[model samples]
Target chain A: MTDPLLSVRNLRVTFATRQGEFQAVRGVGFDLGRERLGVVGESGSGKSMTGRAILGLVRPPGRVTADRMELEGQSILNLSERKMRRIRGSRISMVMQDPKFSLNPVMTIGDQIIEAYRLHAGGAKGQARQKALDMLAAVQIREPERVMAAYPHEMSGGMGQRIMIAMMLAPDPEILIADEPTSALDVSVRTEVLNILDRLVRDRGMGLIFISHDLNLVAQFCDRVLIMYAGRIVETLSARTLHEARHPYTQGLLNSLPRLDAPVDRLPVLPRQDSWRDGGPVGESLETDLPGGL
Target chain B: MLSLALTLLGLLLVTFIIGRVMPIDPVLKVVGDRASQAQYEAAYQAMGLDKPLVVQFFGYIGDVLTGNFGRSISTGQLVIDDIRHVFPATLELATLGTLIGVSIGVPLGVIAAARRGGIIDQVARVVALVGYSMPIFWLGLMGLLVFYGILGWVGGPGRQGIIFDGMVPSVTGLILVDSLIAGDWAAFRDAFSHIILPASLLGYFSLAYISRMTRSFMLEQLGAEYITTARVKGLSEGAVIWRHAFRNISIPLVTVIALSFGSLLEGSVLTEIIFSWPGLGQYITKSLLAGDMSAVLGGTIVVGVCFIALNLLSDLLYRVLDPRSK
Candidate 1:
């Protein structure tokens, strides 16, 4: 087996608020090889925090600590901000939720792409521009030149998302952390974006941490899945075998997803248990507790 | 463009009407009370003020279009010529003032925003508050007392010292430029020293407003998601600020700077009065008190034109700064 591109262990993120130190992520860890790892969780589940912490992009008042975090076996936890900046986009870039806000409104698409390229790709302006254009085309943009000069507002959600993907991938980062890259996109374009992402990762042999709340999409798209609840990874399963997950949270998540084959009367709400927050193995007991027969 | 033209026309008509309705007789003010009634009649006739109000307004509009602002009753010079001469002085002062404001204020604001709630931000906020609160006249006086009377660090008020009188030729009507054009560094230094205190005082006012605006603008830009995108691209914090973030703040700062410059042109009246500097604020005030209608209207029109031009320039600048604009 190939070595993991990135490995994280016992990572925790705590925010110091006016009231007290509130821990958001606790002892969450994963190893990302050159494969798609989908982190599926609902809002406030620390999925986005995991991605941001990996990139070292978390702002002040939020603290991140880990026993071990390595990119290709090089220790990343102790690196200074200046040193970490060298690795951020050139090696591990991020795609945020909203492309409309992620893209600089005043700047042209060409300028933004060229800026990203030149930051790490350092060459002549012409070379950087050529690389940008090539990357834009690589992302399946039909009219590269026209889109290059167009501003962010001029593009649609799909086109803007494509442009964002092109920009993030331009630096040829080893790992791409896409935090809900398609949640803002409509259903029609979501699959298109997924296909593009799949193709790019396959062709480049890059690691991807696909953070999303869409369980069905993750099961359909990714190679492996990590189910998170209350800042803990409750279950890790092969996407092919996600339906066979053992954890109650995972089972609950799966049972909650409305399947077209069953045609249920109503969608089941995820029952909350105070003990579930501990994320211990209580799968079989809760499995029988579910109203629908498994 | 049509609306702009109408606004200018309306401004001129209103000022003209105000001048006509004032209790003082413009002709008597020009000819003097001792002059014969015939002399007063001739002076009014010469100005074509004997015509109907609408005709007189149209006539004034024609003269204004031709760059003739009529004769100044007090200064006895063409109103256009007075503005042309005196404006550059104020321009030189305000330009330098605004330059100081932007150069220092913008960087200070950026730093304060980046280090928000830190000692530097606290210091900047306190300084801005003090600067904004202090009256320009008191600041000007205090500056004069320390820099001029006490330390002898700079020359006393006016465009230049008596030594530079008739020495530097007026090429651009700006002493600094004309002195440089004449290759006279001594005259330039002398001119510079005389303007230093008043310009600094005016600059303090601009700096306060600009720094406060810049701080808010930087805070807004820094919080934006694009800043995160820039960071994710491995761009340095400085690059993220100066390149990505600064550009965002710059668009709004341009409007602020332009408006401040426009207000400065209306005469830093307090700065002018305290420093005994001869500019439009002092000119208009003296003319208004003496009820010199031509000087008053002409000065008002010149100031109005300047304000409109600046506003238009700022609007045009928006298109250049923001590509989202059509």
Candidate 2:
């Protein structure tokens, strides 16, 4: 098989708190190819942290230490800010959780998209502008011209997210790291956004890291799934086989889902014992001594 | 725009009421204490103090509309004429002060905010603290002593040197412009020498205010998501800070700068006194003390109008800078 698009190993993110050094992401790692990979976890599970670490977007005081982190063939961990900037929006781009906070409110949508494109493409104003309008149309904005001239506040949540996708994709990055990109949108538009992502990846063969907490959505949308718990990945399986995941954490997560057909009196809760914390790699077995009752 | 108009109208009404509520009699202020009863009655009648309060208020408004602000009992000149002479000088000083303040303050603020917790930030914080806390009158005096008395580096006092008394024409009433127009470099130098120290002193006061506000504004913007987005867009750190963050922060800075300019025009009274610059602050203060009601009221109105205009200008700037406001 050809080399993966990106690889990470032994990644640890820790914050120095007053109490002590609190490790947020501990020894979590993965490899990504030109396929849709979803990272599913609850909030505080460090799934977003892993996504951010890939782009060096993790802010100070929250340290990222990794044994190995590479993109294509380059060691991204130590690249200078200048070199990293060129790679960021060009070779790899990100769509944040909410467009309300992600987009610059003062600027027009068209100008921002043009900026994203021209920063990497180095084209003239008219060309860049035309390209930006084309991107707006690709994102299925009905009135691309009016949307381009509009401000972020003037647009709806779904429209804003679409504009964000357009801007991030305008740079034509090889890998798109979407960090819960549609969690802020209404349920009605979620499928439309997913369709856009699906078409982009299928047509362009661009690799995707879809980070979200929605297990069912990840199962349906992504090619493979990584189920994380306590800042560690406990299971890695193809999306088709996610319902049959081996780890107790994954089993507990699946059990908690509200099934439309089988409505139980009380949803089964995970019998979270102390030993469950020490489960090593993906699909690793429980401790030798299981004094458990679930 | 409607808010601004309402604000100006409200200001005029408030100041008018304040003047009327004063316990001091306008007749006593105009006529001598030992003046005859008839003379006192004549002065009262001439002031229209004999009329009802509402009638007098409307009468005052009519006179104001017709450009009659009464006569300054002390100077014996029309109040409008005094404003025409003094307001231009005050405006020139304020404009210069604003220029100096903005030039020095904004860069310092950006540097301090960008390098937060570093040596530059520490030094700037201490310097800004001292500037804000230090009395302007004291700073003005010390500046005068060093720049004037000891060093003999600038003109001592007044608007221009006594030597340039009749050299430059007063076409614009602003000495610097008038001198340049008259093609008198000597007069220009004298005016520059006289103006620089006072302007810088006022500038120093404004700089402290403007820089402190700018620092907070920039600090907030630096943490905003757009700044990170700019950085992620392959823009350099300088571009992120100046072009992106600075633009976002400048909306609030406009208001601070404009308010400071208005106060400067109302007169850096202490600086004016130290430099003896004949601006509106000194004019109004002297008029009030001498009980030249016309001059005092007229000066008050002029300063009020200036504040309103500056506020309106800043509001428009905010709309232009942040399209979200529009």
Candidate 3:
């Protein structure tokens, strides 16, 4: 394609701990176009770290180093904090995993959303507030006015996530990173949040990085999927080919998931092999021998 | 709201009764060994001590309502007048001390939390530790020696600083107010200089508690998901910490500060003693030593009132800051 909107090359994030320098993301690299890309991995697999590194939000004691980290063809690694701030909400935005702790507990939903809009828009309070209301409506929130005035604690988890989505979209960022955005919501509300996000990404033609551990959901929604294990991306493939993933870790994860249509007497467990360490031949066979119940 | 008021009223009544019935006979203690049993009984009867405890409590409450706290046993001065003279000084000291505490403590706390584990944070932690560990009396003595003796930058003993050097004491209380009323700049400067040492000593104690509370509060807020969201939204580190994190953490800090304010008003007794600042703590100390029943009772009531009032204020502030309290 004509130069992806964002490109990350040889990205590594290391956290200094009592044990030693533990690498959380090892040589992870990806490019994002104006489409949905999903990074699926279990907790501590470094999917969240990758998102944070891209946004330059990694704090002290946790270091991020990349040979090439660029956004819209411009290198973002060396940008000054002031310049980085100008790009943060305007060009790139992130929605967190839980809305309960993500949203300011004391501030009204409307004030917070308007503040987010005005951070980049530099408009009057009235205009910013109007934009916030419009964003709430865009997120399919009914009675936007009432919801805007509500505090974070007053709203349900689903409603809070919707509000968070509205706020993130208010700045009209070119790229949006949603880290387990619907994981905290009920199963019934999960699809609703995902649909809202999907519709918004398509309408705006924005690049989206959806981070989750649910392969089925990612397969259905994302164009491309990256499977990660132990801070390393073991496989990259088109979502349509996720059922035929070639990485042992990805295959193991898929086998672990309960299947609805399968009528086997007992669910098959994927074989664990020591050679699967560091993505080797035993790992390679694990990906291919999936149907045989090996 | 009515229930809250009733609860407060009940607490005040209980405190008053306890103050009265505390085993030590106020009349005998005041009159001393010269008085006979009959004389002691007569004095106690006049003071309404022979009446039933409930009857005596109601009488005291009624007298308090009417602004009659009886005459001081030591000086025979009206208790109300003693309070009027001393309360202003105590309030001025408390206000200045709290201002110093909050202004210094909040910034120190925010910076320490922002840095997390740097040299500045380490230094702040050390200072907070020292402040908490040092007794008010010891700190007061050390402050006097350093600021007044070694430095010699301030006034000498019995001079009461640069203020009131030549100015007329128009108000007889509140040196700053009297100085201002007389339009005496030199007196004002002197009065302020005298105020600094005592205010700082008290402020240091308050600062210790407030900064510790604030640091923990900010640390919790910094780890919050919204802070991450703020950073992702392109806001600078300063904006995320100060604008978003600071506002969220203020409710708890405010409560700590209000409670500290109440403590300051009760007076940092040692600080007042060292500087000879005639505030309520010094008054109460002297009254207790001399067995001055009226003055002691009056001081207790005033201090009690201030403590209760500050708590109420903190509750109101809590509601204002977090609308979820509504």
lDDT of 2 by residue, B209-245 (tens): 8888888899998888677667667677797887778
How far residue B36's Cα lies from its native spot in candidate 1, in Å, is: 9.7
Q: By DockQ, is 1 or 2 better?
A: 1
Per-candidate TM-score against the hidden true structure: 0.91, 0.94, 0.91
TM-score head-to-head 1 vs 2, winner = 2
Q: What is the lDDT of residue B162 in candidate 1?
A: 89
Better-scoring candidate (lDDT), 2 or 3: 2
lDDT of each: 0.86, 0.84, 0.83
Of candidates 3 and 1, the better by lDDT: 1
- What are the runs in model 3 whose C-alpha is more than 4 Å off? A263-274, A280-294, B1-23, B29-32, B35-38, B156-172
Q: Tens digit of lDDT per residue, candidate 2, span A40-128? A: 99898899888877887776678888888889867888567788888888988888888888888777888888989998998899999
TM-score of chain B of each: 0.93, 0.94, 0.90
Better of 1 and 2 by lDDT: 1
Whole-model lDDT, model 1 = 0.86
lDDT of 1 at B300: 87
DockQ-based class of model 3:
medium
For model 2, the superposed segments whose C-alpha errors exceed 4 Å read A268-278, A284-294
